[model samples]
Target: MKIKDFPHAGETPPFGAGGSGVGLYIHIPFCKQACHYCDFHFSTSLKKKNELVDALCQEMILRKDEIPGPLQTIYFGGGTPSLLEAEELAQIFKTIDSHFEVNPDAEITLEANPDDLTEAKLKMLAASRINRLSIGVQSFFEEDLKLMNRAHNAIEAVTCLELAKNYFDNISIDLIYGMPDMSDARWQENLDKTLALDIPHISSYALTVEPNTALQKFIEKGVVKPVDDAVAQGHFEILIERMQQAGFENYEFSNFGKPGYYSQNNTAYWTGKSYLGIGPSAHSYDGETRSWNVNSNPKYIKAIQSGELPIERETLSVTDKYNEYVMTGLRTIWGISLIKIEESFGLKFKEYALQQAQKHIEEHLLFLDQDRIVVTQKGKFLSDGLASDLFLINLS
Candidate 1:
């Protein structure tokens, strides 16, 4: 059936005819090795890598104009996209530029492992149009790296940042807090090292053990201790305070950045900008509809080769739209804009949200800016629960 026959969700105003623009996410599902805690789609075998890259290019060409807005941002996220040689990555970007009307100033970000980056590699990336690099520097401690089974050691993680600064001004690094063994002093050391770097963006994630990962299995077998809530909470406090002291803004729950160094593509996604996703396990949204490619390498390749897109989509319901806005909005530093919230969900929602805010405000977990309802530091931990309380439950 045509998208118009789906529902009246996007038919409402502020959400546009189908809503705000789109962003393209390309997943390069190849990795030299897997981290014990990761559950993302990736394989360690290099046998099919060359073919996979070709398939990815073909996938991009196959859905060149699938979404709208000409494509403002293109993100190369992955198991470790930096594992590929610069020429290979360039070939894929070339395909995108040829087919998608990518803006001249579009943010082209590549996710890389610290081990994969070097001065030579950085120079090659700089020569290409790739403007940003999001490095996987999970921890700056050797013991933590060992526990996480990360590919790079503590020394390599630090060195990569030094090398990366020579090539890219817009750089983002991922740091994982809340490890069972990561002490406050150790955590402080990691934060100090990260702040010393000249990079702009930082994505500090709380470690979560998802189902079926090796970490979970190890804990199940009693080979490792599970995460400690008290320890995690302590480290979280350290992260917030330390980053704030370093002059970084907590732009999102897991993201912090120096002034103007925010990830344009990711910010667009959170603020409801649209983008196409290509390759295996990639997700795409055209504002009204949400779609994602198949997670299997062979299956994704086969579908693209056979002139079919390996994807499934869902038309957004009014309820889905409201819940989505609530989910994404409440996690940012900007918080929920009461004015926009009213315009988008209606006066009833704004009232209920304010009512919910009152309880948090009394606890000092929330506050009101001139026009926005911003969550305080204490509220960030229970953000999901708080957001759920404000959700438009009966907005069918």
Candidate 2:
């Protein structure tokens, strides 16, 4: 289907009005070990962990006023935040409290690796204001864990869940599908075991062969089979059908949550809400333009210590804004709303979007529920391609 040809006549809007309230993403780039498929900026060494934490706290303190609202959502993502000592994390939180305006009921989340989870640590995290724990339990199968070089085994993954559940009521588990050797039956078994836990949220993602990763190298050498698109599609279908049948709403392409359990932090991003990202390799978006820190941890530390921002930024164009909304919205239950397209971009773009979306609707690849143009079940996997097709040209 052809998308409407809309012109950005003028450039897109800048990020914020004196930095209106923004979500915070604090990246922790240290880990016990690096997974074969992981390309995210992280290191396995603990030598500089404490120093990095101090730097991060300082970074937050320096950038506090840049965010206008008391922090609504604080997400600790990356190099295995669960690896930090609970007290260390608490120190960082205290620093944030000192400089920033954090709401009393802020939805604080920590990304945890299964092997790093412990009963004591869970207690410490709970005692702090961290209300949610998103565990990295990539797969429930022992073979899958070994293939991915995960530090935690199947038993450890399962045990971590049980332990985490005892302390944190708001728990989300991350699972992977369509791995090189992950069979359809095994995938189903993983789903069954996950459903048994009855987690409040589930983030399931299909394995992709990203560049420069060990998985990509393995495929090049024939050490591991290349990813099977057919197999991935099959598993995704199972994921959607099973999760929906289990009463889990497909909130995002890779996320499922029970009623009232959607991830507010992530939702903010999808809905064009402003957010601040701190630490090495983190990216921050403020409704319009986006900025990111240097990927090198040592470099980030050096820059911050010199009293500099330690980042590079890009201004958003009208095309960039429109395309971002299309890309993110199509991946969620909200889809793309004509009203939002109009309000955010302008009325001219809105009229063009609705006119263009009619083609996809007729092709049965998209659903038109009044003002909302949503992707159909068959179109979910092709969401990226479809969104790209509808993008406004000349982003630069």
By TM-score, the best candidate is: 2
Query: Superposing all C-alpha atoms, what RMSD in Å does each candidate have to the true structure?
Result: 7.1, 5.4
Alpha-carbon TM-score of each model against the true structure: 0.91, 0.92
Q: Tell me the whole-model lDDT of each prediction, alpha carbons only.
A: 0.79, 0.82
Q: What are the per-residue Cα lDDT tens digits for candidate 2 across 31-127?
A: 8887888999998888888889988998888888778677778899998998888679879978987888876667789999888787888878888
TM-score of 1: 0.91
Candidate 1 per-residue lDDT, tens place, 1-396, comes to: 222221211222222112234577889898888898999999888788888888888887877767666666778898888887877977887887788776666777899999889888888888987889999998988889999999999889989999988888999999898887788999898888888886688888888898999999988998878888778778888888888788787767788878777777767766677778888989887668888889999898888778888888999876677778778877776677777778887887778778878888778676666556666777887777878877776753
Model 1 misplacement above 4 A: 1-21
Clashes of each: 6, 2
Best by the lDDT measure: 2
Clashing pairs in 2: 12-318, 70-101
